[model samples]
Every structure is written in C-alpha cells, then in structure tokens.
Target: MSLPPPPGTTASGGVPLSRRSLAPDLSRGVMLLVIAIVHAHIFQEMVGGDPQAPGAAFDAATTVFVMTFAEGRGYPMFAALFGYGLARIHLRRVAEGQPWPRVRSLVRRRGRWLVLIGVLHTVLLFFGDIIAVYGLIALMFAGLLHVGDRRLLAHGFTWMALGTLVYAFLNTLPSFTDPAAGGGVLTGSPLADMVTRLFTWPVMTPMLLMTSVFPFAVGVWAARRRVMEEPGLHLGLLRRSAFAGIPVAVLGGLPYGLASAGLWETAGAAETALAWLHLLTGYAGGFGYAALIALLAVRLGDRRGPVVRALAATGQRSMTCYLLQSVGWSVLFAPYALGLASDLSELGSVLVGAAVWLATVVIADVMRRTGARGPAERLLRWGTYREPRSGSATVTAQARSGG
Candidate 1:
C-alpha cells in the first residue's frame, strides 16, 4: 500500500502546511493528558469507599477534586478531539483525491484496531473503554462523510438534542425500574453490565454515542470550514461558545458532581435533572476549553511552545499513548497491580495522573526527537495499509528524511 503524503506535504508534493496543521494535534495531546487525569480520579472514586459515608480526609479531598475536574471535563474533551480527528482525516482524503470508499475502508480498519485495544483495555484494566464507542462512531461517520459540513453540524445538534430528550425520559422512569436504581447509578458485572449499558441504559451507550459523534461531526465541519485554520476570523464564534458554555458547565457540572458524590440521593428527581443538565454542560465545557486553547495556539503562533509541542507529539502517536495510559493506569490501580485505586484519595489520584502525564510527555518528546512513531501507531498503520514489516524501515527512512 502506498503511504499518504507526510505532514505538511500537499497532493502535488509541495511542503506547505495545511491551515489546520499542528494546532489541533497539540490541542488533542493536551486534552488527552486531561483525560488521563480524569480517568485516574474516577477510577479512584469507583474503588474508594462510599463518598457520603464517613471517609478519610484525604479521600474526601480527592473525591472533591475528581468530581470538580476529571469526571466533568475529561471525556467531553476527548470526544471533541475525536470529532476533530475524524474531520481532519476526511479532509485529508478529499485533498488526496481518494474516494470516500477508500476512506471508509481505512476507518473500518482503524475501528477494528480500536475495538481490539478497547477490548483488551476493558478485560484487563478499566471497563470504561472509549475506543469501542469511537469504533462504532467511525462506521456511522463513513456513511455521513458525503454530507456537507452544514448538514453534518445540523445533524450533530439534532442528535445531541434528541439524545438529551431520550436520556431525560429514561432517567424519569419509576424508581424501582430506573436502570440507575441502585444508588441512582448503574453498577454490576463488567460484561453483563456492558450489555445492559448498551441496550437498557440510554444514558450510557446512546448518550455517549451521541456525544462522541456530534463533537466529531462538528470537528469535521470545523475542518471543512477552516475554522481552526482561520482562528482569528472565527474568534467571535470561539468567544461566544466559551462564554455560553463555561458558566452553564459550572452550574450543571457542580450539581452533577455533587450528585455523583451522593449529595443529592434523597432528591432523586433533582439528581436526575442535574444528570441531564450535566450532559449538556459537559459538552459545552469541552467546547469552551477547546475554543480557548485554539485561540491561544493561534495567538501564540508557536508550534514549538513546550506545552503545545509536547501535546502535538503525543497526538501524533495518540493510539500508542492512549493504550500506554490504560496500561499504566491498570498497573497503578487494578486489583492485581498496585491496588492504588482502593487506597488513593482523589487528590492522590490526581497526583498520580500528573506523574503519568509528565512521563508520557517526556516519552513522547523523546520519540519525536528520534522520529519514531509510537509502537501501537506503527502497528495500526501496518494493519491499515496491509503493508509488510519490511516496509516500516522504508517508511521510517522517509519520515526521517522529512517526507
């Protein structure tokens, strides 16, 4: 299989950068770091004793931070980046004169790898594997690739609204019958729970799908419209989105965070309502965060900023870093590993996450200097292209030569 043009390489073999180049990648890396921190905190909370019960001061403080930062923002940020990546991939294919069918094939292949990684992640580590969700979304996106950017955006909002209604309706079911009946949250065996989660819990699978898909679709729309490319021109939209999203996120998010900590258990209806609000606010917050970062990247106009560059490197090898994160977390938190989850307070978990993030940034930076793609990324590329191992050397050489 032939390799696509290298970063900044045009279809005609020129080396001019695309308008969307660098910033989104760096942004995604930063988002991933946040995601890692959030996951660490959530895992800690899940394993830690009941937050409402008399608990250790450390645990209480940790839970508060996780509730405030990790749970509320991490996943949404990841979803937005997913959308952006989807859009970027499609745009790249179109520029290369590749048909949607080829892009679809590529997405399908990539999805398979994602599913494989997610399955491994779920079985051996955390059950909150998002790759499966991404894989499913990829299939849906394949068909939607033909839609214009406006149509994609419209459909995304439609799904978001419809998903919100569906989730709210589900949450309103009778107390005994509600899927979130036990502690007003879903919990059970992993495999069985996942099945129930996919079908019964509208909020779990459907909401996740909707949330993931819309941001991705919006990212695609942004790409097509060159919004990130022309950040200055889109400053008004960015500011408006941030302004509208941040406060709403804080309001909705705070309640949801409290509910998650068992603060609103007695007020079941209020808790349910907050859950719906959180969904909306979380998305808003994610968008707000992305907009602010994008604006900064544009203003700074420094692709080599330490933070920006670190994230960009991570994004370039995201698949590897993502899996590595899962492995690291598993080893740090799993029952068989350090068992840190059971012992860690929210704050402790955040510290662990920070350490993990720093480590990954360092590793990514090292890999970037060496011009080596992350291992998982290399394998995924090989799988997607059906290329032989020997081809890797050629690819690496080309990459090093600034292909």
Candidate 2:
C-alpha cells in the first residue's frame, strides 16, 4: 500500500478509504443528466398521442433529441461507472493484501442488499429502477473482475453485437408482437401494484443484467488501466472516443431518434431493425460521453465554480441522489400518490425531472459543505467494509509494538 491511511479511524474506520479521484466522480456527476432525461419519459403516461401525426411539434422534437442522444444510453454509462467504482475499491483492498474470498463475500453481500433496495424502489416508485439491475449484473460478472483489458475489449464488443442481434430477433418473435410487452398501466392499489411489480421483477432483473454485464466487464477492464484516474496520460484515447464515438453514436442513434419522434415510419421487421440500431449504438454513446467528460475534467478541473462543485458533490453521493430521485417521482407521479403521470406530456415531465435533479444536487452540495457523507454511502461503506482496513491494522500493530 502507498502508505497507511491517516490515523483517527473510528472503531469501524468511518472515513474515506482511499484518496478520491476526480474522473470517476465527475463522470458520475454528469451521468445523471442523461438518466434524468430518459427516465422522465417513463413516468409520462401518453394518454392520447399519435405516433404518425406529430400534434405537439416541440414534444416530437424532444423525442428525436432524446432518441438520438439519451434513451438506451444512460444505463450503460452507469454500468461502466459502477464497474469503475467497484474496481477502484477492489484494487485498493488487493493492494493492502486482503484475501479474495473476503473481498468477494463483501461485494456479494452489498449486491444482495442493493437488490432489496431496488425491489423496494420499483414497487414504490418508478418501474425503471436500475439499482437492482446493476446489483445482479455485478454479482453475475464478479468472476471476470480480474480479466485483462484485451480479452475484455474483445468480449465486450462481441456481446454488444450479439445482444443487439438477439434483441432484434426476439422482437420479431410471434409472442413479442403483442403490445403487452410495452408496460402495465398504473393501478392505484398499493397491494395490487406490488404484486404486479413482483411478476415483472423476475424477468426484468435478468434482462437488465444480461444486457449491461458486458459493459460492466469492460468497466472493470478500464479500471485496471486507471484510465479515468489518469486522464492526462490517456488524452489520445479520450479524444478519439470523444470525437469518433460521439459522432457515430449520433448517426447510429438518429434513425431510432427520428422513429421515436414520429418523424420516421416503419412496420414489422423494419421497425424492429431500427430499434436495434438505437440499442446498438447506445454503447458507443455511453463510452463517448464518459471520455468527453474525462477530457473536460483534466483540462478544467481546477476551475471550481458553484456548478462544478455541486455536480461533483452529487456524483459523490450518487446512490443517495438516485434514491432521492425516485422519492420525487413517487410523490409526483405514482398512481397511489400525485398521479401526474396521466396528465403530463413528455416534455413537461422532463422539466420536472430536471428540477428534481437540481434539488438533489443542491442537497448533495450541502452535505459536502457540512462535512457529512451521503447517508446511503455511509451505510454502504459500513456494510461492505466489515473489518478495519489493512492499513489501519498495520498502524495499530505498529503503535502497540512502540514502533
């Protein structure tokens, strides 16, 4: 280990484990924008909207914009970040000589708890809760935590290709032709709603893990290189991904975006193919966005403004803010609650989502300023880090021996 962590650890060492780096935190900070934009649509109950005829020009435009940019992209980005964060923790612990079994056990336990949290989130709030999705993905792909970058890249691309193909092929199946696949209408009964969510959770949890697992693996791969940790050294890669990947993502996402915006039309196989196109390129978009943000961080990290500080704080407390988002959504849209989902347009929902995001950011910033860690983060650390850090142990032994 570089050095034993500074002393003054609580009985459980309630303190930062390692020096925080900027890139992972910053990338996570901005990732909420993509998440906010995309999820805002899910809460919108499209009561009477014609896909072919665009009655609301602005809403149609927004759809195209989201299609070209946001949808299908956010979760992948989060998956990558999840991998990156876990990898950082894993590497730090390994550096300190912790056994693999202990590490795996800790990670698995954390994942299980996250699944419970995600279940509660889905039952009470938005159906698109990804905490459970990522939790399972983390556990399913944990064995590949040490895979080298070359193999990881190869497997990631291969899975991306196969996943796209499989998604399209499945959509063409006879059973998939039914609109029942879309989603369930919100029924106000809390008990009835929980039952419905349970039925879907089994299917959804697996599908989410399956689609994002490869990306999560790739994230672990990136973590090994410390790519995000050292953006200055990896400027070329960051620049190339930013320039090349973003443009490709934009073009690839365009067809789906247009189709989503009611500006493009197709039927049967053609529509399915277009859907796959969006899903396919979304991986590139997610990677590109992270790269672009890394480049920004390296170049302008020193210029801390209120906006920058707020974003970084929010990113640091991402888990807390993520749950808080659902809290806002539940209060505003759930059938048992405000039920604005039935009345709001897609664009209107986006605005509300942005406001909610802003509120969380401010809250996170306040926590940062007050020397308080995010409550969820604090709990996670306490749960995952059951024993004191090896660094702490070393310091304790040294002091006891009068070194």
Candidate 3:
C-alpha cells in the first residue's frame, strides 16, 4: 500500500496528491464506462458472435449506439492518457535531477512490466487486452521523449495516415485477414486461444503500435502543455474542440455503426473504404470525447458530488478497475466459468458491462477511501521503480490513482 507521489508535483519538492489535476483522472474514470461498454461487444464477437447477426430492432439500435459512442473512442482516449502519464513521470524524474539514461531505463522497465501484465490478462481472461500493445508503443516512443511538440504532432499525424491506409487496405479484405485473426481461435480450447494470442503477439504488437501512435503522440503534445492538468489555461481551445470534434466523430461513425449493425451492408473495396472513413472519423471522435470530458471536468471543478467523486476514484485506480472488467466478463462469460457469451445479446452484454463497470466504480471508491492501491497498480509501481528511495510507487499511481 505504498502511495504514489502527488500529481503535478515533484518528489523532492513534496507536492501533495490534493494538488493533482482531477481532469485527467476524472476523464479516465468516466471514460472507463465507455471502454467497458465498447469492449463488451468486442468480447462477444471474440466468442463467435456476429454483432451484425440479425437481432431485434432494439438490439440493433443498442449495438449501433455502442459503436457510435464508445468503440473507437475509448482506446484512443487511453492512448493519449497513456502518453500523458508517461510524460508526467519523465518530467518529474528530470526535475528530481535524475540522469537521462536512468529515466529512459525506468520508462522501459515500466513498459516491459505492462507487457507482462498484458500477457497474463490476455492468457487468463480476454484476448482483447490493449495494455501489452500500449506497453510496446511506450517502449517505441521512449526514445522520442525529447522530440519537440511540433515534431511529435507531425510524427503522430504521419503515423495516423499510415495506420489508416494500412487498416483500410485490410478492411477491404476479409475482417480476420489481419490482426483480427486471433479472436476466432476461441472456438477451440481456452488453452488454444491463449496459444493463438501468444503467437499473434508479434504481429499484433506492431499493428497496435502503428494505429496507436497518433493518439499517443497527441498525448505527448498535450502532456507538454499540461492541457488536462490545467484545462482552464486552454479553455478556448478545449471548448472549440468539444463543439467541433463531437459531431464530426458521431457522423463519421454513423456509417460504420450502420454497417456493423447490418442496417447497411457492403463488401470489397467499398467496404474497406467505408471502414477507413470510420477510422478517420473515429480518431476525431476520440479527441472530441476527450475534449468534451475535459470541459465537463472544468465546469464541475472542485464541486463535483458523489457521482463525480466515485468516477474520479475509479479513474484513479483505472488499472485495477480495468482488470476487474475482464475478470467480471471472464466469470460471467468464459467457457470454463459461466459461459454466458452465447446466451447474452449484443445489447445485453453492453448493459451488463455497464453494471459491472458501475460495480467496479463502487469498489474503486471504497479502495480510494481506504487508501488501498489497485493490486495491479501496486505491482506496476514496484516493478517500475526498482531503485526506490524512501517510498514506492510509479507515475501512474499518482496520476491515475491520485496517490
């Protein structure tokens, strides 16, 4: 139960956790619901669901709403926050007069641990884990820590274009022809599914890295400015982005949602191109959702009541909460467990995911009041901070858990 250093504060300087920015953690907490809702559908698809399969009108609408609001939006938000969290660590360590090699090694160490955690997560529970991919991306971007914000943005946009083109090309083909292949292995033994994920990691890691670069880099840019930490300083930009980014994102997702819901169907290059359109819009939607959340956090300020507090607490323990979702899904849906995957409708899964997410929030809120670190967060802290001084923790526990 070692506490992390305070957010927006330095170790040597002794900034308290209360001084930390609520926007990032708050946003992450609120967005976890989005992540859970979106991924619930994905988990079903993994266990041999055709979300596009015929269902009731309500199911179709529920599924479509999940796509339009949650799917592509959630991961990118995490990507941005991931880079932002790493950058916060980098800044604090550098301020503490730590050498460059030491900082780089520390970040790399954390990245590797994330991969290990992700491996366990993928093997035992869901095959849709992103932490491993995010870890690899962190490793790749570690060397780019000193790149200027403009340069980072340029590189991010470049990678975004490359990722879109690459994915669009793949989407034009069959769905599983690419990194989408591994989920189908679930039809066999769970051991077989785990084996498939292990084998596919090599390929999927790079693809995930590519698609993730844009948001990660954008996160770097935002981190440099402490945008979320001090959203009030950039209120105009945040407002415009919220206003502008949402509609484009929602509209962009409409076609994909329709396609995924079977309200519209197409094949060949046309389908691929439409998929690309979704990616393009979805990326924007991710940014928009983040901006909107930041704005909401700013408006709520220090006066947020119980709902907000619980969400912020969940956000603080996001890793624990995130892993809990997979745990819940596994118990409720896994073959060796309850095996309800085939039983729940697409809409049903999303509803259950929301319920599970809410339960995790309650759990996280309890953890917060009791000053308990998420099990994963504590482990990650120890793994990344090997040369600990008087305390034990990592940047995430501070930024994420508000330690």
Best by lDDT: 3
Ranking by lDDT: 3, 2, 1
Candidate 3: which stretches are off by over 4 Å? 1-8, 13-17, 46-55, 175-183, 388-403
TM agreement with the true structure for every prediction: 0.79, 0.86, 0.88
Question: Which 10-residue window of candidate 2 scores lowest in summed lDDT?
Answer: 1-10
Write down the lDDT of every candidate, Cα atoms only: 0.64, 0.71, 0.76
Query: What 10-residue stretch in candidate 3 is worst by lDDT?
Result: 1-10
Pitting candidate 2 against candidate 3, the one with the higher TM-score is 3
Candidate order by TM-score, decreasing, is 3, 2, 1
Model 1 clash pairs are 62-346, 62-347, 83-216
Write down the RMSD of all candidates, one decimal each.
5.9, 5.2, 4.8
